[model samples]
Target: MPVYKAPVEDTLFVLKDVLGIEKFNNLPGFADATGDMVDAIVGEAAKLAEEVLFPVNLSGDQEGCTRHDDGSVTTPKGFKEAYQTYREGGWIGLSVPEEFGGQGLPYVLHTAVGEYMSSANMALTMYPGLTSGAIAAILVHGSDEQKSTYLPKMVEGTWTGTMNLTEPHCGTDLGMLRTKAAPQPDGSYKISGQKIFISAGEHDMSENIIHLVLARIEGAPEGTKGISLFIVPKFILNADGTPGTRNGVSCGAIEHKMGIHGNATCVLNYDEATGYLIGAENKGLAAMFVMMNEARLGVGLQGLAISETAYQNAANYARERIQGRALTGPKAPDKKADPIIVHADIRRALLQMRAINEAGRAFSLYSALQSDIAHRSADPAERQKADDILSIMTPVLKGVMTDRGFENAVAAQQVYGGHGYIEEHGMSQYVRDARIAMIYEGANGVQAMDLVGRKLAANGGRAVMAVFKEIGDFCEENRADERLAPFTKALKKGLNDLQAATMWFMQNAMAKPDNAGAGATDYMHLFGLVIQGYMWGRTVKAVHALQDAGDSRTEFLANKLVTARFFMERLMPETALRKARIETGCDTVMALDAAAF
Candidate 1:
């Protein structure tokens, strides 16, 4: 069985030392996220993850979700119960609105709790995770009546949610979607469509499934401009708003996917399902984006969560499993060979994984803080600034984090040698589960293009510049700190590399669009490296502060310092290679004629 101990200590450190989350007391829920409150909340979340979810993870993978002849799906054993425990504990409403029957906590707290659940059982986590994102969309776009009718039950976890944007014909390009919504006399539409790859689409855990779907109204304009969002439920509500009659919706079939078998990815058939428009006509994409952004950030958290779990299991095996002798000599002379951790090569792999995981956590939490500010800050300027940062970083967070996160999973698997490949050892499951995050929530390639194409040019590049400016300012301020000089220096180098790539795209990609398309992925990765590098720099500052204050966590602090150094010295140099590839542009990429193949 795989082991999962939530990184509560690390989370607490980042919360207090790095983010200083308590200082945001002026914000509505910020005051409650005090040291004790955070500890109590996250500590309980950890137990739930470890005790309830973690045990079922491997079983969930093995048993998978079962789809019956009737099209109803049954989650793997223990998944439903785990979700019940989760909802009863008020986990679903951790950051939801108090008006919606929630605890009204800061979003950051929910994010931390999410990380624990994800690390423990990603497939099971999707049930509530998708609900949270759907709730975010309805809360933003829904009318007062709509909010009152849906938000309370969804918040309380009596109902779960799913986003149904993809059709048989399209995934990312909403313009090509063929789903249709026809207007009715009672101000509701009859939605008739088939949406594929709908996660949590037919799960039995919830009493009702609220689908935030995208479709075009009759005679609407062509392409994305005509797209509209609708609230469609599996069962229509009665006068008391309880689920009464079955709607014209059913799971045509659940997809046999590569991973995440515990969550039913369904092909949903809506034969004129009763639906209500949430936002304006021909404006579905705008409303859907609210859910998309929320889901994107959540996916980024998935990346880090998987990586953290993989690292923990791999590190445990390295210490306990007997392996080849150390390059220096056998440290465990009594045994036949030293543990693999003593080998420099093994150390290199483990250290790099640890370095990236640590920094990625910081980046994610910082982004979450920005989200909190954007959503809750009293000052419009503060909110806008935070929103700008969040907008630019969302794609970066999803794309780069998942890309490296999958790499980390593979690295963890490699640590176990042949045992990793076999199913019983459980490493293969991590790799399989981590792979979906990159493809969904907008694939990493689309993410990179968005970074270069839309986001870079959004608001005349204010958001991207805001992120760069923050990193630049951090690098400059810490340049002279003796303890942090190495990190600051390397971070500056990566920052320069990212800037050069951005500037190159500005000069070249505009003239030839393929230039941006060809190099988008590289630029995104390069940008991620610098952002994570800056995360390390900030973390070093925090750790050094603790060290100076006579804190007793000497070994922990030392390990963190080592990880920071590894990130700067050994890992930060990849920016150069990525920058070189970015400058090469689309010459060779588009050289081949269509007939050549």
Candidate 2:
């Protein structure tokens, strides 16, 4: 069985030492997130993940989920009880506004804890993860009544939520969607549509499911401009805000997916379901993007979560499983043979995953802090800058994290040799589960295009420019510090590669659109390398500071410094390759004829 222990101490280091989260105490929830409070929250979440969630991961995957004749779905064994524990603990509402029956903490806390939950059991965590996204959308776009009716229960974990966008004929192209909503006399619409690939769509865990669906109103304009968002519930609400009559919605079938089998990915059929519009007419796509953006970040974290879990199991196995003797000689002369970890190749693979996982965690928390500042800061300029950074980094986070995360999972599996491929060790599950993060929440390809196509040009390139300047300034400020020179120097080199690729896109992509399409993925990864490199620089500085002050975490600090150095030496150089690919443009890529295949 696979084991998972939340990186609580590492998270605290990132939160308190590197990011200095306490600096934002003036912000509403950050004030309450003292050292003790943050420690308590993260430590408790770690206990739940290790004790409650990880135990059921393998069994849940084996049992999967079952759909009954009555169109009701049941999660695997122990899931309901686990969910109940999660609800009673007020974990789902950790960062929600207090008005919505939540603790009203900074979103960074929720995000930090979220990695543990996802790593423990990704399928189970999706139950509340999707709900959090829906709550964020409703908070921003829903009416006063909608918020009052839905926010509290969803926040309290009684009622869960799902975003309904894709249909039988559409996945990314919302304009081609065929779902329709007809206006009624009572100010509600009759929604008739079928949405597929709806995660946590129907389940027995929650009292009701609120689906934020996109549909076209009768006689509305064509294409995406006509699409509008609607709140369609499984059970219609009564005057007292309780679930009353059953609505015209049911699970048509549950999808048999490759992984995350514990989540009820349902084909939901809506037969004239009573629906209320959330946002303005012909503006549903914009509102739905809110959920997608949140989900994209969550998906990126899933990549890291799977990588972390897989790495742990692989590392543990490497230390215990006896393999060939070390190249030099017998490291364990008394034993039958030396442990796999004694080999240089094994250590290289482990360090590769370790290096990325550490820097990836820092990047995730740092990006999350940007979200907190973007939403909570009092100054408009601060908010704008934070939002810009978040916007530009979102695609990079989603695209590069998952891409590399899946790679790390495979690498972890490779560490176990033949044993990794077998189901008993549970490494296969990690690889299968990590695969979906790259495809969902907008495929990595779309994320890449969004980065190069829309995000780079937004507001005359202000966001990307701001990020570039931040990295450049960090390098300039830290050039003289000998302890930090290695990280900053590598980061500066990576930043130069990323900037050169961006310039290539600006100069070449416009003349030939195929150039943008051909090179977008490389550009996205190039961007990710620099961002992660920048995070490593900060991590090294923080570790050095802690060591200088004799913080007493001698071994942990030493390992972190080594990992940061590994990242700089081994991974940061990939930016040059990505930049080279981007500069190659699309001539050969697009040269193939339609009949070439």
Candidate 3:
């Protein structure tokens, strides 16, 4: 069976040592999240992941989801039961506020548990994953009545949620959407449209599915400017707040997808669905963007989760699969051949996977910590600062991590040779699953463009400059630390490359706009590499601190130092290539005429 175990120890170390999450206990919902309490919470989550979710991953991928004549969908055999257990355990509302039927924990804690569930089963975890983003959206922009009616049930997982933005004719261009919401006599709107790829759209796991739909109100202005958001449930609510009459929404068909089969991706038909407006009259895109942003971060987590699991399974296979004798000598004399792990080539792949994944984890956690600070900090400046950092990191985490995550999955598959290609081993599923993260939640290319176009100039470039300063500060502080000299030096070079790339874009993008578009992906990746390098530097610093304090995890810290060195010396050079690519402008890219191609 393809199995997974949460990297709990590493996670705890990052949470406590690297990020120093303890100082944030003064904030609301973090009072009880001390080191021991955090450990217990993660331990319980690990059990649920191992016992409940991990066992069904391969089966869920194989069986997929089934749609019925009545437009209801059924998940894989064990999925509904597992969801109930998740609901009962308060897992759905892990970080939600207590007033709304949640545990009232910090967002970072939720992220830790989310990573665990994601690694256990990306397909199954998505059923609840989309719901959390929906919850975030409603909490931020929903009306009082909407919150009272939706938050409690959704938080408890008795009812799930989904976002409906894409239409048959529109994908990235929401202005092209044709979905219409006509105002009703009783203050409800009648929604009519077709929405495709609506994940968890009509699942049997929940009593009702609340959809945050993007629709244009009748007679509203054209394009994205006229868009409006709505709360269109599968079943309309009764006077007592219980699910009552059936709504006009129904799934027309379930998509036959490449992966994430356990969660229903539906083609929804809304024929005059009774809907309630959210946010302003013609500003649906503004409201929906909140959920989209949250979903983007969640999608990035999918990338990290799949790569982590793929790495674990691949590492295990390498240790057990017998192959050619070691180049040096027969490491296993009794056996005809040594394990494949003894081969230097295989070791290279494994180390690359390890370095990227560990750094990805830190990148994710640090971003989540920023989110908590942004949302919960008492000081206005602190909140604004964290929010700025988060705005920049969001696309970086989504685009860069998904790209690297897909790469790692492919590399892990390569470790198994032909066996990896077969479905029985399940590596192919990871690849297919990871592929969607890059496309959805705004394609990685779009994410890159957003990073450079919108985020770079935001607040007079404060966010990007702050990140640059952070790297410079770390390098300055560690300049004389002989133990950390190599890693610091590499980080400095990566920072220089990143700054050069930024300067090139600023100077060239004005004369030729395509220069920015052509190099956006490369620039985003360059930024990702520098941020990951910073993550590793902080991780090494944390390890050294533990060692200096006479902590007993010396051997583990040594391995961590080795991985940090590998990332700095081996992987960090990619920034140079990326920067070089960025400086190449868009000559060849735009040189070809449409007819010539």
The C-alpha TM-scores of every prediction are 0.99, 0.99, 0.99
lDDT of 2 at 567: 91
Off by over 4 Å in 1: none
* Cα-based lDDT at residue 344, candidate 3: 94
- Candidate 2 worst ten-residue window by lDDT: 1-10
Off by over 4 Å in 3: none
The lDDT of model 3 is 0.91
Stretches off by above 4 angstroms in model 2 are: none
Q: Which has the higher lDDT value, candidate number 2 or candidate number 3?
A: 2
Decoy 2 TM-score against native: 0.99
Residue-level error in angstroms, candidate 1, position 154 = 0.3
Instruction: Give the higher-lDDT candidate: 1 or 3.
Output: 1
Residues 1-597, candidate 2, lDDT per residue (tens digit)?
Answer: 778889999999999999999899989899999999999999999999999988999999989999999999999999999998998899989999999899999998999999999999999999999999999999999999899999999999999999999998999888999999999998999999899999999999999999999999999898999999999988999899999999999999999899998889999999999999998999998998889999999999998899999999999999999989999999999999999999999999999998888888989999999999999999999999999999999999999899988999999999999999999899989998999999988999999999999999999999999999988999999899998998898999999888888888899989899999999998998898898899889988999999999999999999998899889998899999999988999999989998996
User: In terms of lDDT, which candidate is strongest?
Assistant: 2
RMSD in angstroms, all models?
Answer: 0.9, 0.7, 0.9
* Candidate 1 deviation (Cα RMSD): 0.9
* Residue 338 local lDDT, model 2: 95
